[model samples]
Target: METAFADYLDEFTRRDWETLDPEAVADPVRVAVVGLGWFAREWALPGIARSAYTEATVVTDVDPDAVETVAAERDVTGVTPEEFRSGAAADAYDAAYVATPNAAHLDYVRAAAAQGKAVLCEKPLEATLDRARRLVAACRDADVRLMVGYRMQTDPAVRRLRDLLRAGVAGDVVHVHATMSQTMLGELGGDTDQWRLDPELSGGCALMDLGVYPLNTTRFVLDEDPVRVSGRTRTRHEAFADVDEHASFRLAFPDGVDALCTVSQNAQHASRLEVTGTEARLISDPAFYEREDRGFAVVRDGTRVDVDFDQVHQIEEEFAYFGHQLLADEPFHPDGEHALADMRALDGIYRSAETGRSVTLDEDAA
Candidate 1:
C-alpha cells in the first residue's frame, strides 16, 4: 500500500516531472525564512521545521524584536536585516523563503538566487510582470530553483478536484464561478505603515491579496490559460486609498469556457468555487486556504456525491511537498513558467480594469 506522500510524489511526476526517489538525497535542506510577520511566524517556519527534509536554521526581519521573538518561540537562530544586507547572515542556509510583501518578492528572490540558493517566494511573485520575468531569468541563470508559495497546489482537496476535472469526472467544464471575501483583514488595521495597504507593497488590494487564489486555482484545475479578461474594481475603504478593496473579473479560455471571479475586503464571509460541466457540477466549500475538514461535493443528475478529507495543515503539506521535491531532485511545482503565466493573467486583469475593455494575451505571451 502506498502512503499519501508516495501518491503525491507519483502524481507530481506523472503530471509535471520525471521520477526520483525522495529518500536518496544525502543532506537535509537548511532553510531561512525572510520575514517575521504573521505568515512566517504563525505558519511557514513551524511547517518547514516539521518537514522531514528541511530544517529551519535562521530567520530575518527588519524588526529585531519580532525576529527575536519568533526565533525564541520556534527555537531557531535570528539574523537582523542589517546582517542580511551585508550578505553574511544568509550563508548558513541552503535556501530562503521570501515571505515578504508582494513588491519585495523580486528583490529577495534575486538576492537568494545570487547566492545560488533555492527560493520559495510568497505569492504574487512580483508587483509587475516585467520584474517577475527578470526574477525568473535570474534564477535560471544562477541555476537556482524558484517556486511560488501557491500552497493550494499542494492541498489535498484541491488535488482531488484537479484529478476529477482532468479525469473528466466533471465532464466538459463550461463555466466556473469563484468568490473569496473576508471582513477580518480590513477590521484589523494596525499600522498605516503596514505594506498591505500601500500600493508600493501589496500591489493592488483585494485582487493581489485574495483574487490570486481563484485565478490561480481556476488555471490549475482547468489546465488552461485565460485567453481574454475584463474586470471592474473599487476602493471602498480610506485605508486602501492607494489600492482597490473589491474586484471582480471575467476570464475566457480558448475553448469557450468562462470563469467569473470576485474578491472583496468588506464582504461578510468567504465563498468557494462552483464548477459547472456538461455531465455534472462540483462545489467546493470555503475552498481557498482551508486547513481543516476541507472537502467538496459532486452533483450529478440532481444527486450529491460527498467527499471528505482528513484535516491537514496546508502549510505543513506545502513544506513537506517542497522537501520531497528537493530531496528527490524532482522539478519544482509552480516553477518559473507557472509564475510567469500567473503574472501575465494578473497583468491582464489590471489592464482590463483600468481600460474597461477586454484584454487578450498575445500568442507569444502565453
Candidate 2:
C-alpha cells in the first residue's frame, strides 16, 4: 500500500465516477421523455435506456404517430403534447426530460413544475434570456429540482482533468482555447430545413447548438464566470442566412483567466480544448464529444503525460446523476440557476456579436 514518488508525480488521479455506477435500491426513478425529436428518439432515449438510476416510463410528443412509435418500441405510455400540457398521464413518471426546441422548453418545464415533478431540460435553458429566467423562476416557485442537461459536466475524464487542475497539476491556468464544430447540413445528411436552421426555434445557429459546449464546459471546469465577453459570427450558406454558420467568442474570466471559443456548423468535425498555465499545459482532443475516444494530455517542462480514457455514454451519466441526486434529495450542480448564468453569458455573447463591442456581465446575473 506504499506509494512511490514517481507514481505520485506521473499518475495519481482520484476516481470521481461514483455517480455513474449503479445504485442499490428497491426502486429506480421513473422518467418521461418529452419531444420525440431526432435527438430525443435517437440519442436521449437511448441514453435514458442505459441509465442505471432511471427508467423511461412515458414518451410524449406533438406528433401522435412518433409518440406511439417510440412508446411501442420502448413499451411505455405515449402522451400527446396536448395531453401532457393538460396534466394527463402525470403519475406515470417522477421526472420529466424536456427535449423540445429552445422556445418550447418553458411550456414543458412549467407543466412539469406544476405537477411537482423534477425536470432535466436540455441546455441553453431556453431560446431567449428572458425565457430562461422565467423557466428557472417557474421551477423555483414550485420548489422543484430543475437540472439542466449538460452532459460534459458528468464526463469522468473531464472530472479527472478538473481534479488535476484544482490540485495544481496545471498551476494557475491563464488561458484556454476551445473549438467544437461539425458539418450539420449539406454534408452530414442533416436536414436542411430542420429547426436548428430556424433562427426562432434554435435561438442561434452554430453558437447556440455547438458553441455552448466550450462555453459551459470551460465555465464548469474553471468554476468561474466570465467578467466580459466579445463575439463574432459569420453566415455563408443560405440555410443559415438568418443565423450564424460560424461563430467565435472571447471570454475574460476572473484571476486573469481568459478563453477564446469557436464553433461552426460547416467545418470538418473537431472538438478540442487547450489550457495554458504558468507551470503546465493541458490539451483534450475530441473533447466535446462523449461517444468518441478522448485524448487528454498534460505537458510540464517539455514532458507530456497522455491518457486515453475509456469511452463513456455521457448522456447516461447525466441522467444517472440527476436521478440519484433527486432520489437522495440532494441538489445537483447543473441546476436551473447554473443554466440561467449560461443563458446570461450567451445573451452577452449575442449582444457583443451584434454591437461589435465587448459586453460586461453582471456578477450576480440572478
Q: Write the per-residue lDDT of candidate 1 for residues 124-240, one digit (tens) a residue.
A: 888778888888888999999988889888876677777777777777999999998877364444455677778877777789888889998888888888888889899867777
For each candidate, give its TM-score against the true structure: 0.90, 0.94
Q: What TM-score, to 2 decimals, does candidate 2 have?
A: 0.94
For model 2, give the RMSD to the true fold.
Answer: 2.7
Please give the lDDT score for candidate 2. 0.84
lDDT of each: 0.79, 0.84
Clashing pairs in 2: none
**lDDT by residue (tens digit), candidate 2, 160-227:** 66766777777789899999988887544668877788889889989898888999899988888888
Candidate 1: residue 256 Cα off by (Å):
0.3
Task: Give the CA lDDT, 0 to 100, for residue 188 in model 1.
Answer: 43
Off by over 4 Å in 2: 1-23, 186-188, 363-366
Error of 2 at 154 (Å): 0.5
Model 1, position 100, has a per-residue lDDT of 85
Leading candidate by TM-score: 2
